[model samples]
Target: MTIAIAPIDPVGRAFFAGVVSGIDLRKPPTAAEVAAVHDGMDEFGVLVFHDQDIDDEQQLAFSRALGPLETATGDIAAPHERRVSMDLNDISNLDKNNKVVARDDRRRLFGLGNQLWHSDSSFKPVPAKYSILSARTIPPTGGNTEFADMRAAYDALDEATRREVHDLVCVHSQIFSRGILGFTDFTEEERAKWAPVRQRLVRRHPRTGRLSLYLSSHAGGIEGWPVPEARAFLRDLTEHATQRRFVYAHVWRPHDLVMWDNRVTMHRARRYDHTAVRDMRRTTLTNEVSSLDQAP
Candidate 1:
């Protein structure tokens, strides 16, 4: 089957996202289709596919066709308590029994970090390259996912600010982001497991060779800077980067599959009723090289 891609943006602005059609993700994609998807990803940081209707195995198969998948780790759920396979991240409010998680549940509180803008797996030594999320079920209202185009954000920055951030490296940790919401109830082992990793503040995308500001809520501090100063700087950059013009808010529909390049965008989950179920499954592609290793 042939694949078609159309810009998601309205008539005049620079398009950072696209809607893809004519390829079924439930079955294994052909090599040519996979290459087309890669080309689409390089051109558009986010790609939306409607009516995917794929299960975990199909999702994994399709994601593997694009690149190596990153195993689910560092989740608040204990290994035995997880409802989904290790290969997929269970992005939902449901518990193992398929019931809505308690409002005060530690797992739920820990997940609140997702509401903050971040590039998936930024806390890892080798961060994520892309994230493919499928909407199995969606809430009747709210729970929209917002994505910010970091490449555009970087381009919009003043020359002086760009020069200042060019060589900066920031330390990222899950502990730091969750702490912002006062959810620091981690065990010593958990703390050790989620230890901070350093990444370049600006990255040059390997495929397009375009530069993007690599900012994340997971980033706690910039290397060699005082805590307050680093945090203030990061907060300022985040505020500037997430201005309405730079973002796209995606209102999900059941069976929708959205794939985004984590290297060039930051995304956050929107607020929704905790009592209503919103089931999303994500398969992330691993970045073999760290942002720190890549030339800025």
Candidate 2:
């Protein structure tokens, strides 16, 4: 079946987000449907599908239909202690036993970093292409996910600012993002596992050929700049990119699935009640080439 795409904005002038309908994600998609989704993603950057109740296996299958999946890694939880498979990211506040994690749980603390804007898997040598997040359970209020349109954000930059960022390279690390929250209790192994990776500060979308600012909370330093200066500059760019005009806040419902191109967007989860369960599973699509390898 063919999918339908509609702009999320009321007057249909929004440049970055759309709602996709007319196809059920619980079943595998036809080639045409897959192509339509890709087209929608290239044009919209973010796509939201509502009321499709799909489980983990179905979500993984549908995600794979779009692109190769990235293996989940570097979360605060150890392998044996994780509640979900390594193939799927467990974006939840629940422990392995399906109980709400304790108030001071290390995993929960680490997860607080999600509140900061970031591109999924930016810390990896090969960053993610797309991220599909499925909401199984959502809080009655709050816990919304916010996406920033980096492409539009780039378009809004002044000529000099754009030129300044166009050729820059930055180093990204989960340790840096988590460190921002004052959670520095990383095991030595964890530190090594999440060592910083370099990425272009500006990226060209492969399909649309549009330039986008690749800003993320994971970005701690630029290649040649001093640490303090680089971080301050990154913070300024993030603030500008996530301005109210450039962002789309998604108030999630149960069984909603939302996907966004990591190359053109940055996203973050909002605050929710720790005592409540907010189970979100995500499948990340691996980029064939890293930002380092891509044309600026």
Candidate 3:
């Protein structure tokens, strides 16, 4: 199918591609070529490609052109593969997995917020810069991904709200969120390893310094506010940020490549028939880990 590129939404300034077929992502992209992709991505926040029938090496080349891939770690990261693959299909049983549940598994359901509205990894001290996903095997129906334009959301926010959030700090706790999901059993060692998570409500882009939304479902609450009040506040802000009118829906097809700026957008996974296989390979760009009380 011919590659048809389009904006992320009717009102979204960013753009995304809709693939009738797919694109070849195996071969290495030249510097000039990749520059064009980055240029569009900076303006649009997301750029979708179709029909990526490439091998692991080709995928690595394309991803490296964007940024260095984050280290492959945890259950979601692919140890054997050249790049990482985030597998939402298999939730971690950290006990048998013999890993620290203090962070990974507890934050598991937090990813469920992807079904809601959020900036990717916004709760981190140094939030994620970008994300790349390639459709390895997509289910016949459903599991469509939707992305919201946060830059637009930021622009859309009332001036008063923006000023209020300008200096606010919110604590982002994976363990706290895990506790909400009912995983309260933690050894002292685990607790010690995890301090309370927190991040600034607003972040400046490392390069352009353009402001972007900086909060997530993993965000337990705004720092130092009543629990109920913080929850209400965060919920309302996210709700307004991702109204249906500001979204771009992508129906996955095999060999599709989608890239988005983590700093400027929020995305969610739509419900799909779990009985069917919907596999995808993802690489999160290594970014400075964001933290408030924690260290990078």
Best by lDDT: 1
- Compared with the true structure, what per-residue lDDT tens digits does model 2 show for residues 1-296? 56899999956346778999899998999999999999999999999999989998999899999989989995888888888899999999998999999989999999999999999999999999989999999988899999999999999999999989999999999999999999999999999999999999999988889999999999999999999999999999999999998999999988999999999999999998889899999999999788988877
Model 1 clashing residue pairs (backbone)? none
lDDT of 3 by residue, 1-296 (tens): 23334564444443433222223566666665667666666667778777777655566678888776664332222244212333222222123343323434334344344465554555444556677777877767888888877666777788999998877888765456546546676657555544555677676655555676666666778877898998889888789877776667888778777888876677877876544655566666756655343211
What C-alpha lDDT do the candidate models reach, one value each?
Answer: 0.93, 0.93, 0.62
Residue 95 C-alpha lDDT in model 3: 30
Q: What TM-score does candidate 3 get on C-alpha atoms? A: 0.76
Per model, state how many residue pairs clash.
Answer: 0, 0, 14
lDDT of 1 at 168: 96
Where model 1 places Cα greater than 4 Å from the true spot, the runs are none
The TM-score between candidate 2 and the true structure equals: 0.98
lDDT of 1 at 1: 63
Positional deviation of 176 in candidate 2, in angstroms? 0.4
Model 3: lDDT of residue 294: 28
lDDT (Cα) of model 3: 0.62
TM-scores for candidates 1 onward, in order: 0.98, 0.98, 0.76
